[model samples]
Target: MEKKLSFRNSSFLLLFFLCAAGNVGAQVNPADVRYLGKMEGYWTMKTKLGIYAEKWKRVDEHSWKGRTMRIEGNDSTKMDDMRLFLEGDAIYFSIVAVKDSVGEPVRYKLRVLKAVGFVAENLQGFYPQKIIYRWKDETHMDAHFEGKQGKTTREIILQYTRR
Candidate 1:
């Protein structure tokens, strides 16, 4: 037996997923990503690995680019090249390591959008399945990374302040 969805039925499925995700629209909107502008500038946090910083630059109305680096004595080592961009009415957060590979970045789709924060998720990854960012105020922000790895569920929270 063979089955096919009629145009009306297909449209219904699309609407279903869009409503379930609660992301406002299935059609991408530049305005939806405008909140990212609040993150522009440099911020730092102290971690067991040492000091880390994130710098953001608004590339356009639809995107923002960032650098995540580890501070050393006087120089910093770039850990990742990150981007938040909109495509087809949806927002995506992507990160690629600062290595020669230049392979595909790990990407997460915006699943929840709110006034001060948003939740992005990658269903295919074994670890870091979710990345959450929130602006606590003009000078502070929180970043949360969570996922299941090797039979353990892990979540790391980092609080950064303007530097």
Candidate 2:
């Protein structure tokens, strides 16, 4: 049979659990919250696909400038330029072909669906329906893209580090 907890014992156990969970009267200063936004900056990543780089800067209190570059293959046979904007509660990341040619960057738009410090969830207009961003730390993050459309499911993982 389960033993019933005494009133005092139950109260003590509840207090203990709250303390152990680190949720006792926690506080976050507004200044500290704003400080989290400082993470905006340029970052680069070395990858088997290419040298992928991005720049993020605050354009205003509620907007940001985002730029991306990709140099593909050892010979740098392919390059792309992408520029985007992040407004309060949303993002508009778009890919643009820097040069007109076959296999040029296809212009497309991406939107932010969710976000937290250093972490963001985005959806591209193309096949991929979901994107995840996980910050390894203040200077690094990992991104995962996954999608399934028309019998095709593609996924790409990328790492980004502060430049």
Candidate 3:
């Protein structure tokens, strides 16, 4: 009797899991996974600011994603935390601008200041920054960075193309 009851319980658990899986919406599909996969590659960058190229790599399966960007020539200066979440067809991202200093990382959170024509944002902190990006293609992008450092406020426009 115990053996029979155990088999029945196992069958019920299997059926419940199958039904639960079917009901969960927004579960990433094969094409979504494919698009996510395609994001991993080298990207060429052109900007009025100073820094040149940015390399992107898909370092996660879902939920939390990470990428690293290093300035050309100088290996010392690098920006980390290019993280984003996927919702429908749009990708939402937040990156902390950490100076290449030898000490602890300085954190900055980018928030949406406006999204009228193209999405734009004023970063949250004492030293605030604004960032805007528009999709050039399915795999290409262009962005603008503007911020205040110390007593100076500066702006830069940059292009990013996936390779």
Candidate 4:
């Protein structure tokens, strides 16, 4: 009877310490986990038709998820679902558009060029060859997309304001 009680007490203490260690491990910050923290929030851009809004949220220590939509008149249409995550030393940005619902997501690699912003690129194709994100302020940013269309180079700039 005494041996049985000793065995049970040993097992219980082992389990308790294991659980406590796991809780402590969870508190450790992962590598570059908070790199995208500045981008988390509700943002909007005004267009001629109406408004385009984007929402970004931190899903975990290493990932941020975003959704974008366009509101025109009284109708709202989902634009895309975006995910940004840190892997190894690189940050990946993926987008799955509503129109291309069945295909693999378009992916870009983001490289921090300076303290103010990063540049993302997809070298596999010409449609969205490069994208530059620069912060005008804490509450405002400009995203510039550069691509090729037939024989011409095209660029589009999107101005975003935190809402």
Q: What ranges in model 4 sit over 4 Å off?
A: 1-33, 98-102
| Winner by TM-score | 1
Overall lDDT per candidate, in order of appearance: 0.72, 0.47, 0.45, 0.65
TM-score of each: 0.75, 0.49, 0.45, 0.71
What stretches of model 2 exceed 4 Å from their correct place? 1-39, 72-125
Arranged by TM-score, best first: 1, 4, 2, 3
Model 1 TM-score on a 0 to 1 scale? 0.75
Which TM-score value belongs to model 4? 0.71
Model 4 scores a C-alpha lDDT of 0.65
Pairs in steric clash, model 3: none
Across residues 23-46, which tens digit of lDDT does each residue of candidate 4 receive? 353222235446468778988888
Q: Give the alpha carbon lDDT tens digit for every residue of 9-30 in model 2.
A: 7444543443333233333222
Can you list the residue pairs that collide in candidate 2?
none
- lDDT winner among the candidates? 1
Better of 3 and 4 by TM-score: 4
- For model 4, what is the error of residue 79's alpha carbon versus the real structure, in angstroms, after optimal superposition? 1.0
Model 3: CA > 4 A from native = 1-40, 46-51, 58-79, 86-92, 99-123, 126-128
Q: Total clashing residue pairs per candidate?
A: 3, 0, 0, 0
